[model samples]
Target: MAKFALLIGVSEYQPGLNALPGAVQDIKAMQRVLQHSEMGDFADADMTVLENPPRHVMERAIENLFSNRQKDDLVLFYFSGHGIKDDSGKLYLSTSETSKYQSGELIQTTATAASLIHGMMERSRSRRQVIILDCCFSGAFAEGMKAKDDNTVDIKNQLGGEGRAVLTSSTATQYSFEQEGEDLSVYTRYIVEGIEKGAADTDNDGMISVDELHEYARKKVQEAAPAMKPEIYAVREGFKIKIAKAPVGDPQLEYRKEVEQCVRNGKVSVIGRRILKRRQSELGLSVEVAAQIENEVLEPYRQYQANLREYEEALAEALQHEGTLSQHTREELKRFQQLLQLRDEDIDLIEVPVAIEKDTIKQSEFLYQKSTETLIYKLRHQLVDITSTEIELAEQKEYKDEGLFERFTERAIEAIRLAQEETLRFGHNFIGTEQILLGLIREETGVAAQVLQLKGIKLADTRIEVEKIIGLGSGFVPPELPFTPNAKRVIELSLEEAKTLKHNYVSTGDLLLGCIRLEEGVAVRVLENLGVNLQNLREQVVHTINLSKNKNIQSQ
Candidate 1:
């Protein structure tokens, strides 16, 4: 089962484009990874790397790579280049000469890297196609082309059968960064090293599988930079990968110094790194141990470091408070001495200031009753500020469930239950969210969701036109509806509406009104969970509802 790779990385553009040291670095590093990593051995077949290639050359490179592939064969296509989108978010592959970055029109009328990939996939007889695109705006490259018009068709959905798998360097709107000591893009560096580390190398042989490479690339990228996520969208299960298992150690923080020393001293390495790669095969170590040793390249004691920082911070805060209190005491003691001097002639017992020895001691026993009054006043002001924030948070948390509107919790709980079902029925441990959404979508008839569903609003329609509404890493909130004090208030507002002239048990359409009324409630929160803006869902729902009403009237 030999696998072939079509690797394309472009760094130098025909001047005036964003300088992409990333593309060249990505290709060279991946090549070494493919050679030394287990995937390179397992898929140890023909691989081509087109460095700084022109557009036409890149396309040719792909076509040539697939020239020998078969339906059962695995094909991996890697691209590292600059990408941009049109106004419609249609992604375009930068030819060594794509001038002027167009914001809105970027995606509408552009030729994309994904389109190129789709062409390769359609032409190839390969059963599983794994594509890794490590470039700025890489997610845009896959937006229009990877999935087959159906959101469920592409690599991310893991629905591949005869199609390819797609892995992107960054989601839409963001750029990938560099790793320390690695010339490759941070993402590419880890991906290649991950493969070399045998995290992707499944067979214990020195070869990494295509799937393993993808997972390794994704997990490593995510850990290194949580903000810029590397995604793996698979259309099919191509390879049985042996993920680089972490070495077994003390579950608690019992042997951390020993662990750090071992890592620093070369007894360990993280799962995906190039530094100690040469020693991996020679170690004859378990995959877990090997992976852990490789991960050490990053030094995974941040939690302990965080704890240490927190301790230092607490000490500083305590000292600051101590300084402020001491200053207050010094002033109070001075006032007490002045009062005692005033009372010296009368020698009054009640007004006598308590005499103390040293500067520290004199301040320590200064008048407490007056200080208590000032402390109480400060405490009240602090309490007021804290109280307001807690009240606001309480309001927000009340709708955390969106009053059953967003049942992320319920869905999560149900997901666990269904996971049990899956294990009981099929005996697999990986119960994914996609499956949960699929199952829930089929079973749901809630009043709020029904408005969209009734008019043929497919949840999967995001495939065709969602990225335009929500750019990468964006969030949205819906518009306002009438304030409803209670559930009955929602019903009352619906009844007051012109459309629901005659109603009985409240059709799902009426629930739309209810959702809109409670727009400030769970409805908006649920939309946020799906990454759907309230405005987008509102317009879509209105359009669908109107369309349905028109059809019904026509029939009548």
Candidate 2:
């Protein structure tokens, strides 16, 4: 069967339209896969590429690419550029000749219309037609779309009947995004990666179907750019249309897959070790290998330092303009400030060596140091007493926190903040273990809550039980209540629990387990009174954590 592809990209637009740097890159990436022998296998002559083409050129390319094709022939059309909707609600693909600021009434004339391409694809003799648009409001390419009420099965059934499909980078209203420091747009980056890395083949079938490609790219782009959502509209059941052939026997790519999985699971430390282990297993940890791994680690380390400073500066600005900031923005600034403070402590730990007396838990001590901000950032190995600094350095090896907040997932941070709110609600001067328990309960969607639900425990019942056990506190509540010693210990042990479970983040489950393991807090007493079998409950929590992790992997 004859196969063809028309790849269009516009990186340079007229004065009125903003230029996109990644448009050209997107075109080149797709061209590579479409022409790869193992993938699309389209001959170089069969693939047409238009870079910054004018309105007429783009229209002619689309029309000619789809014209006079056989019923079984596959025709694929992809566009990467700016898509703008006119006042009349007609979507136009901005061309090199299009100047939104100066064209005035000629805007429609200077750009290719989405409806024109849709009409051409619908009318094409080819039974299998695929349109992929990567631009702002690209979803507009799908004409006559009904209300989005169908599931994957329904979409598959419809596509199976029609053999026509349209994929867009984002919804008709949302803007497609580019990565912060990458050369490709967020949507296109994943699209290229999915094809290149064989990740789009969800079933290990060695074939990347249109549906699989869209699903893989959609999930990835959503992860990297949460604001943009990719869409798939199938006119009939071409869902199984083979887009690419998966690669095999590539060990480096396989290892990179592991690294990606670790990232999704929030296993930041595992990333460095994975790199180190891969190097050692493949090349032995020679000087060159160590240097390479160190360079890799150092890039992110330096980036973390830069990011920490940026967050600090933003916090400073927010503080200066505190009166004009919204409550939500102010709260964000506060949380960011705390994160920066935590990062500074991490850097200091790397710079200075601390003496640990009678502590087998080096990680726990690190957390304590981070909480207290033991050394000022400026005091990076520059203490007043050079002799003491020398002695301390001689006594112990250096340590680094390695992106202090990376270990904590977004949910974990929310749980901690909720715990503080619990402390305030109880009118307590300090956060206690009971407050931590309440915080976990209040994190309704947390794994801890899920496990507790299986045991017939509810947040409301737990809150009542907690109040009865703690009794009412005095009306006086401090605005800046610190964690009580027990609470601090619980937090430390929670980190240990996370490490022991081989999980990266200190999850709500870890917090609950930590409180129970402490064995001397009001939290423990409450759980005991409620007739909880601590051992079984802990096991259930671990199981739930694993199940959630697996679910995330499968979804991705």
Candidate 3:
């Protein structure tokens, strides 16, 4: 019996029908195997190859192949092109002329009806008929055939015909795919491998059968294009027609399978090393192709390593502080250490503890639970807030004077130091406005003390009253004590008070005026409790500032 094969592949197509350069390669690969001397062993004269043929030419070729065929002749038809389903659900092998506009009509005219091919194959004189299709939704070719058999149904049971079979690249709902940078479609490549290399002999037989070929191609295609599932349909018990004689094996495929299995299992480093060793060269793959495969697996790992390096560098820089860490820096170190599983040995540059003291009186550390950066920022803002005088409906200019900050009078600086000392003596972690008031009262010869003395507000009595309002706190003195917000506000107001009085240097008089003008705080309440008239206190503080300013002016 003569074996006749017709191969049709379309790479060029009309607009809206994407061109398939792989389709041409697919047909050529299949033709090679079929015409091979010991494989398919079919004569070249018996094979018909068409590239980008029109619809009429394809119809004539199909007719001529099946019409004059003898009963015992074997007819194999293969198509690698675009398979599309119309609105009526009929499948069509799209031609080069297929277009999106009036797609159903265009497909009907330019494409071959898959059902028509099935009908023609059934009516053909030859019972030994095989139709192989490697196109999107090619499984639609066997849509009408159904039987009580499993995936390997006998063709006679489904179509009630002997020696008729169909093999498709993908299921009706699936789109066959082409690998990026590869010349063949995923399904067709495996089909070619099955025919040429004899990997289709799943049962270890000496020949490659149609069922075995489908089994091998389906599995390989699924591995390459996970979304596709190749299918096969057959008639009668003669479905196991040996298409190709089996070669010993394709060692290239064997190595590729191992590499692919490693990739699937996430063994990137192992695969990367293997690829660098040029192990893929055994499979006839070039160094560039191997590198491409390696890069795909290693790209994510490389990114993670890069990020890890940056993280480690940041963590190392944080560890190099001389004194106590800022609460923000401490917390960052803590989180990073946890993430990287960093041990003491990993960061041996410093002998310091990574954690910040949780209950410390240091304002930055104390506010760490709330937010370190915010508290420091707010504190820094107080510098501006304190130095500026507020006027009703007046635009305030931002003053940034580092010199003015360093030019505080010696007595004024001494008073602030005393306030911090008094806070510690009172077993308080924070230096409140009350402590600042005590500092002003205790600076005995300062203009504030002299003014208070004239107003019958003695230092001893004021201290007693201050202590009464604020009882002693727990004696947990931290290494560094920061002023309370109220105290810091009082200091800011003192700077504003000095500016308002036209004094270049802040004094005890400015401190007292700032305390009196401060709307809220224990200082205001204590002065009020002592029945000190705020208007008179303001007058006395302003008069003291004038007297000092005049003395300086006179001395100059």
- Once superposed on the true structure, which residue ranges of model 2 sit more than 4 Å away at CA? 101-106, 138-161, 179-181, 258-264, 268-313, 320-556
Instruction: Give residue 39's error in model 2 in angstroms.
Output: 2.9
Q: On residues 32-135, what C-alpha lDDT tens digit does candidate 2 reach at each position? A: 98899987788899899999898888899999998999998888988887766666666667788876545444357888766777678767888788878786
Stronger candidate by lDDT (1 vs 3): 3
> What stretches of model 1 exceed 4 Å from their correct place?
37-39, 42-45, 101-113, 136-163, 179-182, 201-211, 239-297, 300-374, 377-556
Query: Candidate 1 lDDT, tens digit per residue, 439-531?
Result: 233323332333344334455652223223322322221221111244334434444432443422232334445445565443334445555
Give the CA lDDT, 0 to 100, for residue 68 in model 2: 90
lDDT of each: 0.43, 0.63, 0.63
State the lDDT at 444 in candidate 1: 37
lDDT of 3 by residue, 408-474 (tens): 5545655666776678778887778888888777765566665665567877777778889988889
Quote the positional error of residue 76 for candidate 1 in Å.
Answer: 1.6
Q: Indicate the TM-score of model 3.
A: 0.44
Report the number of the highest-TM-score candidate.
Answer: 2
Error of 3 at 72 (Å): 3.0
Each model's total of backbone clashes:
36, 8, 5
